[model samples]
Target: MGESDATIVSMILAGDPRGLNRFLSRYGHMLAEYIRALTGDDNDLFSAVYEDVLVDILKQLRVLAGTHETPEIKKLSGKGELLRPIFESAARTVRRRFPDLLKASEEPKASPLPVDDLAAFANSIDHVDFKTLLEGLAGPERELLVLRYRLGFDYAEISNIIREARVQLEERLVNARHHFRARLFASQQKAMV
Candidate 1:
């Protein structure tokens, strides 16, 4: 059944059981991975959290099935359009049932997206702007950009790779961030002017 995400979402909202089964078959692993990401490697905790999050998701789907007024509902299309609620429910369930895990995860963690090094730059720029800025970075400065956004390898990993001390690697990243930000700020000013 190669139905589009919009079709599956509509089916779900219309109370078709197959709609939810299709959704779970499509995105179950994503939900599990998200739970794992938030809760860390407490392997057994996965089932408990997954069950709670699943229940929350089902409850949400049931409510949405009865909804009528949300104009945004009409705008949905791809799988991308349907995932927001599942993620929000997962986050809410983790917060409510495992407040400790949620609290600890609030501290910044490494991510696949290179946000820690870019810091303010990452926050202020859109994806195209970020790619443009990344293109501007060059030489060792480019490679040495410490990625501490999702997978946890920080300066130490970069230092090990480049044969620099952790302190030196961090300093280089700081310089790279400042240089990157200066270019971004200049571009913003240019656009404004």
Candidate 2:
């Protein structure tokens, strides 16, 4: 069986360098996906963020092992939980590095449909339609939805990762959902005609 997260963390804390390699081997793909989703598939930005995340992980190894009970590291239960704070820190670093990108993500252009029409069309849709509609959304919107639904992150976790207030994040998510439903409705209507 594969080593547990607790074992890996313990190894790293004990200064076994291979533990770092094991950690990266285990979580690298997830880190890459998270970075790619948030940065709109900008490979260059992804690389930078990836490196920063690694450095941060190494620097904060002790803290992540739950050395303290307050501030930053709360409790390191499993790999998934351990990654949350690290991802949030990496996101903050990336946002600072690319302020312009953050601005763009924050203010995506308005949809073509009128507000009333869009609202009227926003209804429950099938999975395939939802997937297509999600793809049609702007980068930030897609990222937000993916983080929430796909990754199972709560609003507080998402807010920390995106560096937005909880209320603002909620508004963005609502707008994203509306836009997705609107697009799906339009597509379905087009297919029926």
TM-score winner among the candidates? Answer: 2
Residue pair clashes in candidate 2: none
Global lDDT of each candidate: 0.59, 0.66
All models, RMSD in angstroms? 16.2, 5.5
Q: Please give me the total number of clashing residue pairs in predicted model 2.
A: 0
- Encode model 1's per-residue lDDT on 1-193: one tens digit a residue: 7776667767777779998799888878777655655444567887888899888887876566456335454556455555656655765676678766533111122223333444654444553365455445543343333233322345665455345688877886787666666666655544433
| Residue pairs with backbone overlap in model 1 | 110-148, 110-149, 110-150, 110-151, 111-149, 111-150
Question: Candidate 1 — what's its lDDT?
Answer: 0.59
**Candidate 2 lDDT tens digits, 1-193:** 2766666667777778887788888877777766666665467877777787777766666755554333333344456656676667666666666554444333334435445554444542343355555546666776777778777789999998877899999998998877766676677555444
Candidate 2 stretches greater than 4 Å from native: 13-17, 63-79, 105-139, 182-193
